[model samples]
Target: MKIKIVENEQQLQDAYTVRCEVFVEEQGVPEELEIDDLENEAIHFAGYDDEKPVAASRMRLVDGYGKMERICILKDYRGKSYGKELLLFMEQVAKEKGIDKSKLNAQTQAEAFYQKLGYTTISGEFMDAGIPHITMTKNL
Candidate 1:
């Protein structure tokens, strides 16, 4: 698997496709909520299996810290470390931009996954798009 920074419309669309499969189709997140206004301002990453896009993540600077969002991997591609690779790549991007901290709202079911990546929950459970979520943060 290889990860690339989305640099063009095609790349962005590929990232969106993977996200749609994971978030909208698999998890039932509303389409309107899954695609948001931040795409234009955020840095997006797409992870590929050969030439097929299989995972994606997005990050943006928010109040001097890196805010990561919309991380997803195709169901067929899960359990292969693609999610962790995409996450670490995002953190490296943040660190390169002088961001020492990163934050994300992790689904409650996936909180342990983020914790394994060195993030700690900072907020109580809350509803996001009808799914339980908790804010998590990590220092880069």
Candidate 2:
């Protein structure tokens, strides 16, 4: 598997497709909510397995820190560590931009996944798009 910073329209669209499949079609998140106005402002990353886009994530600088968002991996790619790899790529990008901290709102069920990556829960569980979520952060 290979991951790279999305650098063109097609790559961006690939990232969107992954998110739509994971968040909208599979998880029941509204399509409108899944694609937000922040797309143009964020740095997107796409992961591929032998030329097939299978994972994606986005990051943006927010208040001197990096905010990682919309991390998704296609169902077929979930157990292969693509999600973790995409996340590490985002963190590397953030650090390159001088961001020493990163934050994300993780789905409740995935909290432990983030924890294993050194992120700590920073907020109480709350509803986001009708799903339980909590804020998490890690110092890069």
Instruction: Please give each candidate's TM-score.
Output: 0.98, 0.98
List residue ranges in candidate 1 displaced over 4 A.
none
> In model 2, where do residues sit more than 4 Å from their true spots?
none
**Candidate 1 lDDT score relative to the true structure:** 0.94
lDDT of 2 by residue, 14-75 (tens): 88999999999999999999999998899998888988988988998998879999999999
Q: Could you say which candidate leads in lDDT?
A: 1
TM-score: model 2 vs. ground truth: 0.98
Lowest lDDT block of 10, candidate 2 = 76-85
Enumerate residue pairs that collide in model 2: none
